[model samples]
Structure formats: structure tokens, C-alpha cells
Target: MTLTEKLTTEFRQRCEGIATEKRSLLNIRAFEPLPADLLATQLGATILTPKQIPNLNPCVVAVLLDSDQWSAGIINQNPLWIVNNPRHTPARRESNLMHEFGHMLLKHKIVRFDPDTGFPLRRQSDEDEATYLGGCLQIPRRGLLWAVQCQMTQTEIAVHFNASQEMVQFRSNVTGVNI
Candidate 1:
């Protein structure tokens, strides 16, 4: 199988596990938004905007970043604190938070900061996996198929699932669904 196909399978399995463990339906048919905040709460992780973090640098905060930039990261390992970029749209925020949750679920190690850049560095594999899982959490393949079967447009599916249009398009590409 292709790397994306493998990742897709793994993501689906993880979604099923999360659903079963959390006593929530996968809800692939309804194109429902996955309760990422609820999942974070259940996992004992606190989600916060950059401004909410104590003594954070104002210049580097979420409000200053571009939408296409990195949106969130796990700042603490023990207490599990996540910092999400608030400047992003609500749908992007959800995807960002879900990406951090994906890291937590995958047990990715705390990122090592680059001394020169002062930015955390992560393995490409880990990043790819988390991104894939986050996208899956936002829009499962079954959900995409259901949306297609329902004659939903990309915008309609994005709205229904609380996902960005880019996310909808990405899902369509990955799942080979025309939407």
C-alpha cells in the first residue's frame, strides 16, 4: 500500500479506538464534528491560546502568525498543555488542536528546541502521522463517502463537519471521492 493508504488505515483504527474508549460514535454517516475539546479534556490535556500562557512573548503569539503556518504545539509533557493559534479560523483551530491530540495519542516525545531558531523540531514522520490522524479525526473516509453520497458540495461538507475547505479538498484527494 502507499504511505498515505497505510496512514489512512492507521488513522481509522485510532479513530475507532478513540470512539470506543470515549463511548462516542464514530458518526461517519452524519458528518458530525468530532468533539476534539472533549477528547482533550478526557485525556487530561488543557487547551490554551498563546495569550493564555503566562509570560508568553507577544510578538510570537498566535495572533501574529499567518493562517498557513504551524498552528499549535504541545508545550508541556506532564500536565499536557497545548497552545493553539487563535488567529486561525475556528475550523483551523479545531484541526490544530486535534493535531496536538494526535501527538499525545501517538506518544510522541517532547520536541527538542532548536537553539538558534528557538523553535521545536519534530521528526517528519511524526508530523506526517499527526497531520494524517488529525485530518482523519476531522473527516473520516466514510464521512467523506457519505457526504459525497448525499450530494454535498465541498463547502457544505466543510460546514457540516466543521472542517476547512482545504481539509475537505485534501480528504477528497486522499479518499478518491468527488465532492
Candidate 2:
């Protein structure tokens, strides 16, 4: 498998393991605010912020990039970045950060390439997986499933989990139920 594939597979495994624990996944109340430094450490990356590295090489959480910026990752040993698009709900950011971690874990295999002038970490399958598992990391499938079984609208689920509308929509699709 390619780096992205391998990373997604492994990440899925880790997520499964997390699913095994008996903790209440619905206990997820807020955005699960991840510290930039801690998130970098969790992903095993040395955090380099915009302040430390300047616009060219700052490892950014890009919620909004004009024509020039990408969200997250290391590029050519220079700027490793992530998008901080406010368009994403706070929960979206949480999942997105995890997706960004996928890139870091996967991309080091080949030489770090320069930013594509876009945060194209994973577009199709890779992007989908990242976002999928990112949602799982925030709210596990089992718990969310239980919530669905308990009769919650996608809007209610989104509200309860503090997830984005799109995330709740996707999670519902994965469950293959019409709620």
C-alpha cells in the first residue's frame, strides 16, 4: 500500500482499539480542544507555529487560506501546515486536526514535498478516511450508533456531539439508517 493507504489503515486500527473501551463516547461535550503543541506531540511532529517559522514555513492550522495557503503538513522540511477554516464547526476542527495527523504519519515515508499551494492532504478516499476516522476519534461509531438507536435527528446528534452537520450526516450514512 502507499503511504496514505498504510497510514489510514493503521489509524483505522487504532480507532478500533479505542472503540473497545467502555467509556461513554457521548461524553464528548465540547470541541475537545487540542492544543497545538499537544496535537503535534500526539502526531509525533515537532510543532512549528506561524510565529516561529514565518508565513513561508509556519506549520499552520489553516481554517481559511487565500490562494496561497494550505492547511496542515510538513513541506520540504519547511512549512508543515493544517487549515483552520472557521467554516468548519468546532467539532469539524477536531476531526480535521486528526486528519491532518494522518498526513504527518503518512508523508514522512517519501521526502517531504513542498506545499502544493493548497492543503490537498487527501482529496478522495484519503480525505474521506481522514474525516471519517477523525469523526470517530471525536465520537465513536458504537456510541453514535446507540444515539441513533435512541432516536435522534441528525441535527440532534450534531448538537449533542458538537459535531458538524456534515459529520453527523456522514456518520448516519455509515450506519446505513434513515433517521
TM-scores for every predicted model = 0.80, 0.54
State the lDDT of candidate 1 residue by residue for 1-179, as single tens digits: 44366566666567545544443433333356676786687789998877788787777664445445668889898899998877788988888987887788778887888999877788987887777767777787777888888899889999987888998998788767778
lDDT score at residue 147, model 1, on the 0-100 scale: 84
Model 2 lDDT at residue 92:
53
Runs of candidate 1 exceeding 4 Å displacement? 1-30, 57-68
What's model 2's TM-score? 0.54
Best by lDDT: 1
Q: How far is each candidate from the true structure, as Cα RMSD in Å?
A: 3.4, 6.8
Q: What is the C-alpha lDDT of each candidate?
A: 0.75, 0.50
Candidate 2 lDDT score relative to the true structure: 0.50
Model 2 clash tally? 16
Q: With candidate 1 superimposed using the best TM-score fit, by how many Å does residue 160's alpha carbon deviate from the native? A: 0.6
